[model samples]
Target: EQKKNITYVLNGTTQIQSYVKQLIDVTKSWNCSDVTYTTVRLEDFFADIKEQALGLVEIYHQKIDWKAEQSDKKVTIAYDPMFRAVMNVIQNAVEHTKENGIIYIDAKEQDGRLTFIVEDSGSGFTKEALLHGTEQFFMDDTSRNGEAHYGMGLFFAKTVAEKYGGGIKLSNSENTGGARVEIFFLSSQETS
Candidate 1:
């Protein structure tokens, strides 16, 4: 079934082909099983994520008003799965954002913890969504209307963050007027 879908896209219009290619690349990142923690540079991690975000924004037909900033930092982490988590949330942000919306990516390491933030310019999540958004299969209208979403993105992201001695925080971005999510990861030791 997935192959059929891929074939169809490959045979479709140029935009569809591009979107499918981006989708496949992003999909591959999610299947990473290497959970070991190792020292990694923050700039390298952000560069990878920003590239993925660029593909996602283009595929989603959003403008490239993206920004990424980080302080001088280095930390040990299972960056593969964490990259998947970051991509998933940024995709979610794109889904909720209006056309030509702005998305912001910021990160910093402070006091032995690394904090990654993604905020967008869309209708913020409802209060209920902010509270239960991380629950498995919990989709809300703002992020997942009648789409194929299983509501597992944020749930899996939270799980990954937690498994690494960190957690996720969701809230409305007062500045961007959209949903804001912060993923926190401890740099000291691996939890599992």
Candidate 2:
């Protein structure tokens, strides 16, 4: 079946604004902690992924690589939402994985669509959880260990993906005992 047109302008605009505000608040609170904010570039984002992985290693003495596989096709998306989508995926991977766990990212274009896959080597979720993963405030109490996750990350990411005539899917990771979140972006022609 063709993907549904999931764009809701009012809802999307509100979510995007809220997410941007949260990101800005967090960055401002860092003050002078060597945190750098710049236009989101693929390379720079990957660098931050590496840095976060290294910090996780330091804390848990684990080693993992957070690298996105190379692809020939390049698509320029809105910087803010794309960055937030990627950051949310990375944050989820870090939060859910145990020490020494691995997270893998792969990007490619297939069948006229660009795809990004984020997978982690953590405990996998139940089928029910996967089904409802994109619902706002629909956190699985069993999965969330009393953490203060807003549970809106995937919801907003899915919103942004749909706004771009794309789609997002959550499933069990085939390589790891963790979840895999895939974001798909349809070409402009497809949208037209």
Candidate 1 lDDT at 86 equals 72
Candidate 2, 6-49: lDDT as tens digits: 45666677777876775554343334443232333344545554
lDDT of 1: 0.73
lDDT of 1 at 96: 79
Candidate that would win on TM-score: 1
The C-alpha RMSD in Å for every predicted model, in order, reads: 6.5, 13.3
Indicate the worst ten consecutive residues by lDDT in candidate 2: 34-43
Looking at candidate 2, what is the lDDT of residue 78? 50
lDDT of 1 by residue, 62-161 (tens): 7645455553456677777778777778878887777777788776666777677888888888888999998876868665334446566777778767
Name the lDDT value of residue 148 in candidate 2.
49
Error of 1 at 155 (Å): 0.3
Which residue pairs does candidate 1 place in steric collision?
Answer: none
Q: How close to the true structure is residue 131 of candidate 2, measured as C-alpha lDDT?
A: 86
TM-score of each: 0.74, 0.64
Q: How many backbone clashes does candidate 2 have?
A: 0
TM-score for candidate 1, please give it.
Answer: 0.74
